[model samples]
Target: MDLIIRKYGGTSVGSIEKIKKIAQKTKDDINNNKKILIVVSAMGNSTDELLEKANQISKSPNQRELDLLMSSGEIISSTLLSMALQEIGVQSKSLTGFQAGIDTNTIYGQAEIQSINNDRIINEIKKGNTLVIAGFQGFNENLEITTLGRGGSDTTAVAIAASLKASVCEIYTDVKGIYTADPRIVKNAKKLDFLAYEDMLELANFGAKMHPRSIELGMYYKIPLIIKSSNDQEDGTLVCNSKDIKNLINKGIIMNNITENRNRVSGVTSEGNISKITLKNIPDKPGIAAKVFEPLSVSGINVDVIVQNISNKNKTDLTFTIDDKDFDKTIKTLEKESLKIKYESIMSGKDYGKISIIGSGIQNAPGYAAKFFDTLSKINVNIEMITTSDIRITCLIKNDDLDKALIKVHEVFELDK
Candidate 1:
């Protein structure tokens, strides 16, 4: 029997009616002779509501307690879905993260999955029962409940699929598939039928809905992942290795040669929750860069898009971007090291956003950067910082101009077509 794993987002199981609909879908799958495992996220905005309730009680809720509280959302959804399935005459079982044997590190919030003991999952499958596992929450070495951060459920689904060696992992979301740009932001943005895992990873990291860790796990295990919408029967995007994609194109199943030059530009993405910090007049000495970033790293703050200017009079300026939520913590960390680092001044700006274009071999493509900058120039948008990789080019711009920049850039690359 073929084993299949399907993951539904919160919106998919937001209400009783939707849960019933999912029950019908699962019944159909069971009748098709496929052993099914379902991973469900918390229903609707319940997780957010939980956080709001916690904040109402305390300014800084304890991380361990917050994880335990937040994990209940998925548990509620999973159990409800299981009951819905049984009510519809299909045998099913609901299991929490710990019950399913998801082991992780000791981190309370943002814990990484260390391993999964699939014995229990296999036992349920052997009984011809549909297993509905709660997503995002896992147990640490100490057996304490820990929650994966944002998009953690996606990670959970992929990790389970990998461990079980399932045929494929399906991620059902609100959108039909991954697009060249956010469809709402670019009216003409086109849906990509397939994507290389590397491209998908870049897109997710820059701000796409799919999680980067999920993509990374999928890539590592060579698992095929499909992203589609639960509300509709439309085909979703397939993410896999480039070689696998090439085989599909050669088979004529995919009409467009995604590996070709015309399709070189994969997508344009923008992240608005970004802030830049600058340390001015720092002594440009050996190990200065290390000294400046080590504290932020220790504080669990991710610094991105760093640029250090050439030394002038043995001094230079260092600037970097971080997520808005970590800005205050980053500032605090830097201040504590001020005496040790001896910087002239520290300045931070929260009105910045990053726009990135992702594709394969983009760095080798002549005039791509020129065309990118030229398009922005035509719209009078100023670029603050520039960063690039073999497959992506990112630019920092004012948050106020993000929408305009995205639209113009999407058009320039003709991604809408």
Candidate 2:
């Protein structure tokens, strides 16, 4: 018997009708002799609604209590979906994250998954019953409820699939699959039938809908992941290792047999809600960089796109970008540590966004970076900061110009065609 894991996002199980549709799909799978394990997120905007309710009661709610309150949404979803399945004559069982044996670190929110004891899951599957597990929330070493951050459910699904060594992990979302660009922003964006795990990871990290941690887990476990729409059966994008992709290309299975250009640009992505902070004229000493970032790390704030220039007069400026939501906390943290770090001044900028282009072998392709900047220049868009890796090149620009920049870059790569 082949075992598989499938995860549906909030919008997928947002209503009773959608849940019934999912039940029918699962029943069909069961009849096909597939042992299925399902993971579901909170229905619709229930998570957001719950958070709003918490905020209405207290300005700064306790993190531990907040996690406990937020986790209820997924419980509601998993149980309701299980009821729907039973109503349709399908034998099913609903399990919370803890009940399914998901154990994590002690962090209340944004907890890292430490391990999964699959004994309970294995026992449930052995009974010939479909197991529906709640996503996003898990238990810590102290056995307290903890919630994974945004897109945490995806991580949960991938982690479980890896633990159980399932055949495949399927992620059902609102979109058909990964695209050359966000279709909403670039109307002509084309869907990619296949993507390398590394490319997918870069895209997710740069602001695609898929979670970066989930992609990382898939890559580590060599698990094949499929991303498609929940509303319909469509050939969605397959994400796996580059070796697998190359094998398919050699067999004339992908991209119309144009393997020669396999190393070309894959996609362009943009992320808004960015804020940049620069610590000006800090002493260019060995421990200065550590001093600046360690506090932010301990405070649970993620820093991105760091750049430090050459030392001038034994002093240099350190700049980095972070999610706008963390801007205020970051400022406050730095303000409290100013006397110790001893920087000349602290400056901040908001309304900035990042645009990136990713592919497998883009670094070896000559003129790609030059061409990227040239395209932006043609549109009168100004680039603020630049970063690059072997597979990606990123530029910072004004948030107002992000849409125009995306369209121009997507066209330059001819991704729409």
Report the lDDT tens digits of candidate 1 across residue range 1-417.
556789999999899899999999989967867577999999999999999999999999999999999999999999999999999899999999999999999888888999999899989888877999999999998889999888889999999999998867889898998999988888998888888898999999998879899999999999878888999877678888767766545643334555422478899999997999999999999999889999888787878899988889999999999999998899999999998889999989997999999998686679899999999999999999999988999999999999999999999888876
Q: Which stretches of candidate 2 lie over 4 Å from their true place?
A: 242-263
Q: What is candidate 2's CA lDDT for residue 143?
A: 90
What do the candidate models score in CA lDDT, each in turn?
0.89, 0.90
Quality of model 1 by C-alpha lDDT: 0.89
RMSD of each: 2.5, 2.6
Candidate 2 local lDDT, 199-308, one digit each (tens): 99999999887999999999999887889899877767888865666554453223343122263888999999899999999999999988899999999999999999
- Top-TM-score structure, candidate number: 2
Inter-residue clash pairs, candidate 2: none
